[model samples]
Target: MGLTQFSFGALVRTRWAYALRGSQHESLLNTAYALEAAIDEIVFIFGPILAAFLATSVHPVSQLFVPTLACGIGGAVFFSLKNTVPPVLEPIDVVAAEIPDAQSNAVTGQPAPALQTAGDHAAPTPSPEDNGFRLRRLHRPYSAKPRNVLTYRGILPLLVVFVVFNMSFTAFDVSMTATMKAAGAERFLGLQLAMFAVGSCIGAVIFGSREMKGSHWRHMVMFLTLLTVGYVVFRMVMGNFLILGVMEILTGLCVSPLFATGNLIVKDIVPARSLTEGLSWVTTAGSVGTSFGSTIAGAVLDASSPHMSMMIPWIVTLCAVPLALLGWFLARKRPGRGTGRATNTAA
Candidate 1:
């Protein structure tokens, strides 16, 4: 649900940009954003809503498949639309009938301009310079050059920080849902998640504004430290759903800048061709870490009390304080590295 809300809101802005810009690249990107937003919205809203309604009016487990089927249909519709549309407009060449070459001047060794037809009257062909067409030449977009691109070497460490941070948080998230349900507070869990998404959006906007002004890796570290404090507050509030929701929302607002900063970092460091692949690998690493966290958290639930589940996320999040410090240290060192000098104290 949290992911869906963020995705949908971004898509709204993206689609408008594409429509106004009328650029084929933007259009294709916007279409993808729209389809992804649709699928995520359906998946996030349908299953939980169905579970809620069925728990009250129908057999919960028996009707679960209805929502599952809805998700499948929604996904299929999105996929079909995606396939129906080409990714973007392809550059095409329009050809005209070739005119036979005329004899060259013997002394100057230059061919005479050919004749042309205009309104049934013959006209001398214009020179290449006057005609604005080269007989044989190569052309490419200004955006194509290697130096105009960024690469993974500059961005890999930033991605590493992102994956580590998200891995720790995702672990907390998996445990959070289970913990809330165990505490008999499942009714408000969806709403809490939605609020978290809202906060994240707000945070992203704020971070974007600041990034436009200048970079702030030290500030990010401070923010993460503060977010860790919020987690501590969250852990202390055991049975209160309202408090849990509020704290989680605050946590989202605090940490989302860090999430968004990763993208900015990628944009700075990665080349256009490899950006998607680099981001995918970063996400994959985070997923693997989340899986580990989930397994550890879930295992605690099976063998210990529900309250004990908070330990995993808390431990993992705390691990990030040192990691954040390291990130800040590296960021400071980055500028100095270009000049081959050490400026700041080491982490």
Candidate 2:
């Protein structure tokens, strides 16, 4: 249940997610978010630790195989666990389910029935044609119908921002290695990464252990701003390995917390009907970001001096800063952001 709660609750309604009789999607999403944060903290540590143990007997290529094997084994266990899988719906049942809304539904486009009142009229069922019901196969993509994915509600912008932020990170990483090589200390890469991962773990622990009470929007803004600062400092400290290691650690403190904040934001704003897809989009955004970052960083490295290549990350980080601010602004405007009291903020 703990592991598969997310995938298992696909058919769950937002109301049912909170109800006693059904699964609690909110709590499930919360726990999943925590697990994701923990993964970020551990991945960097895992690489070095795994490599150290494998170095004695196995070849270098075998070192790469270890993590891949771990992932496959872990995924098999997750899939085998009856609690993690979502309840499957029949094809007919899937098509029959309407996209629920506060007032009107998407597929049916009819107002939801309110509570019974003394003067309420007797309800009438619509014919199949009237309800837009059609016989169709399961081959169609789910998005062929209108979904409650909030494109205008800052979700797209946040994804864009996430891309740019990770772009900066990848660029910084490429240049960091190049700078270390240029300085004749190429062996320090693992140490720098380890320090950064340690800082991230500490940050995740601090955020996870504390009661999450503030607006996720505000936290996203603050954490991202701090992360931007870290990238800038990464550029400045390239000449000194000691300062570079410390700066990497300091910068890493924002990574897991920023990721957690983004998850919270998605949960708050993305409609329950499209939450799973929306979460997948976020993952896709990171992949796109990584592609943009690594490719551009390579070009920059080829064209400029090692120190000059840092500008790539610096510029991208600035771009992400504005997006983070805009995301925070839009999130503040969303209906429910967890903060009960309203105060003066920017438009």
Clashing pairs in 1: 150-270, 150-271
Model 2: how far residue 51 lies from native, Å: 5.3
| Predicted candidate 2 versus true structure: per-residue lDDT over 37-96, tens digit per residue | 766668767777679668757875778787667667875675576653344322233456
Could you tell me which residue pairs clash in candidate 2? 4-84, 8-86
Model 1 ranges off by over 4 Å: 1-49, 52-111, 114-151, 173-198, 201-212, 216-223, 239-242, 302-308, 321-347
Structural similarity to truth (TM-score) of each candidate: 0.56, 0.69
Q: After superposition, how far is residue 276 of candidate 1 from its true place, in Å?
A: 3.5
Model 2: residue 40 alpha-carbon error in angstroms: 2.4
Look at candidate 1 and tell me the lDDT of residue 210. 38
Candidate 2 segments whose C-alpha is farther than 4 A from its true place: 1-32, 48-57, 86-152, 332-347
